[model samples]
Target: MGKWLLPESLADILPAEARRIEELRRLLLDLYRTYGYELVMPPLVEYLDSLLSASGGDMDLHTFKLVDQMSGRSLGIRADMTPQVTRIDAHLLNRAGTTRLCYCGSVLHTLPRGLWATREPLQIGAELYGHAGPEADIEVLQLALESVRRAGVADYRIDLSHLDVVRALLETDPAAAARADEIFNLLREKDVPGLAALGPDLAPATTQALQVLPTLYGDLDVLEKARAVLPALPRISQALDMLAALAKALPGVDIGIDLADVRSFNYHTGVVFAVYCGGWPNAVVRGGRYDDVGRVFGRARPATGFSLDLRELAGLLAPATASSAVRAPWGLEPDLAQAVRALRAAGQIVVQILPGHEHDQQEFVCDRELVLRNGAWRVEPLASAEPAARPSPSTAI
Candidate 1:
């Protein structure tokens, strides 16, 4: 028989990294819980229709599809948690006004062969449903910032954008659908010349907006210039106004707006944002507003949320330091029973060496390993459970 192997872009987390990541996950979940966002575990897979309910744009292409034998219905591995959460808010929560929900889970996606994109990604995030004002957006943004801070990510920047602005400007013109798509693609790539080649069928006013598009990034000042040229575009103006408000609220935080950003999920009809830090191309956190996601599942509710890619965040993690080590008490063979009970009483992560697994002692993954040698007891350091310790395990009576 041929050897079995993991698929591309997928691999095991192993003990060392898995434990570390679990700690980070716990820290984030606790933070979310304290904010009154109850945690919910969405399924790893769902009916294809359920998964696709709120997802749009290139999302459909990235999802992994399969046929479920039990139900004989199409199923898809969840590509994102937002859609599933939206369904819950609509059909389950049934809140007339608002609901705050949190989730931590793994998501799967298909990607180009040889790409670094993990087929499996861990997501930790929260969703706020049924709020419509810019205040809701501000709340979501604040939570995102707090999540990063709790995770110890101090160096990062928030890149903000408004989907309604771009869409409103394009929909007002008479350009063909294909032409509009082409122009968007070009703008995404920052190809000003290709955008110009779309030919100036665009009205002079719209053309001027197009020209300024390349420079539509920076502080609140850009918002002023945009309004002067597209004064009648209320959708764009409203979104810019919200950005101005958000900037004022987020004092000392690095904030900027990108009007040309169109990569937001298909459901997002308002402000969209991504959080980035130096040395990484992937956004650690992504979120947006989806007012109609509830309507798709037979319930009408507004929703907004943001999720952080745990895998990407893990990539930027720094190694352990000496001050972070964990220690456990040593036990003698005569005191084995007492030591085990004492450790257990002290709320320590105690693992007794069950019979026949003596050889497995070398593989234990606790903060400290207790062994009964001769009449004395020994304590062994579990490097994975804590930071670096003496290379040797200790012995005592």
Candidate 2:
């Protein structure tokens, strides 16, 4: 095997893609900041129990576990950052009022989440803690849509689901409740046959509701259908009302409802959502209310946030163009050095060409050049043809 070869689902991000990812990261962090979200960077690895405390079984299966060398406790490479951020809010900061936190980092998954996905994803997201109202969910959801919008994703919609709806139906029958995990898997797959197979053990109403849930997807009309068909459980009605309220909150945006979307059943408690774009078969962003998550950290606060793999989101957009740069000659002369420093300080990408590498291709497109004219460096546009050729160090005045 080639020494440079990475594992099956892991690959290196090349220069172009890396630049795009970095740019998007900065843009998102800035967006979060404007909303008063303070940035927090949790370690890439932590004690297993604490790391998986709020993530549930799905995250547990994806996390890479190892024994700590010094402490001898089991440690895990985090597969998600939400729980870590939760711990920070619950234990570290312990702020009495609202705490808005955002994070961006790498998370290792045991396998690729999709056919073309990478095992190691650069996850970026924002979480809001200490508020349980629909307003918090509304704020987070709007920010999520704005994230992709600012990233240049024009065609996208948000699919909203509330876990409480499913939980309520299951609670009506002990047998259905006992087989909650299996039923959730079936619902996510939209496996009507499998759901029907469980009908013998489940109550007639529960069985009917479970089967009908899969078909209860599409636009706002699905909510009306749900009310008429599903059992008249208060929690179910409340969950449906919440979904309608969220859809109403975002009037211009495309919205969807999927009652059967229980993929995150174990993790979220209410109003779960996923943002989907045209080309990607998977959700680009996933988040929802997880009030119970903080409880595990000894501070049961209302928490809701969303995260997206920057790499995945970047893939959906057109490749970024090479940034325009200023070509400068490599030199130790005080004037030349000072000129280069000035351009750099002014937020320009100044590429200094070495003597031997004058004809080598550069990652940046040098649209302008720093030339010495009349004993002082001056900025001038390069000849149309000059930009294509490697910058010449000998051209230094």
Give each model's clash number.
3, 0
CA lDDT for candidate 2 = 0.91
TM-score of each: 0.84, 0.96
lDDT to native, each model: 0.74, 0.91
Error of 1 at 143 (Å): 1.0
Q: 1-397 in candidate 2: lDDT tens per residue?
A: 9899988989899999999999999999999999999999999989999998788766878889999999999999999999999999999999999999999999999988886888999999999999999999999999999999999999999999999999998888999999999999999999999999998899999988899999999999999999999999999999989999999999999999999888777888898999999999989999999886888889899999999999999999997777778878899999999989888988878999999987678678887788889898977777753445444343332
Model 1 segments beyond 4 Å from truth?
1-4, 112-115, 176-180, 228-232, 321-335, 349-397
TM-score of 1: 0.84
Error of 2 at 24 (Å): 0.7
Full-model lDDT, candidate 1: 0.74
lDDT by residue (172-223, candidate 1, tens digit) is 8776233666766776777777767665666665666665677788766777
Structure candidate 2, residue pairs in collision:
none
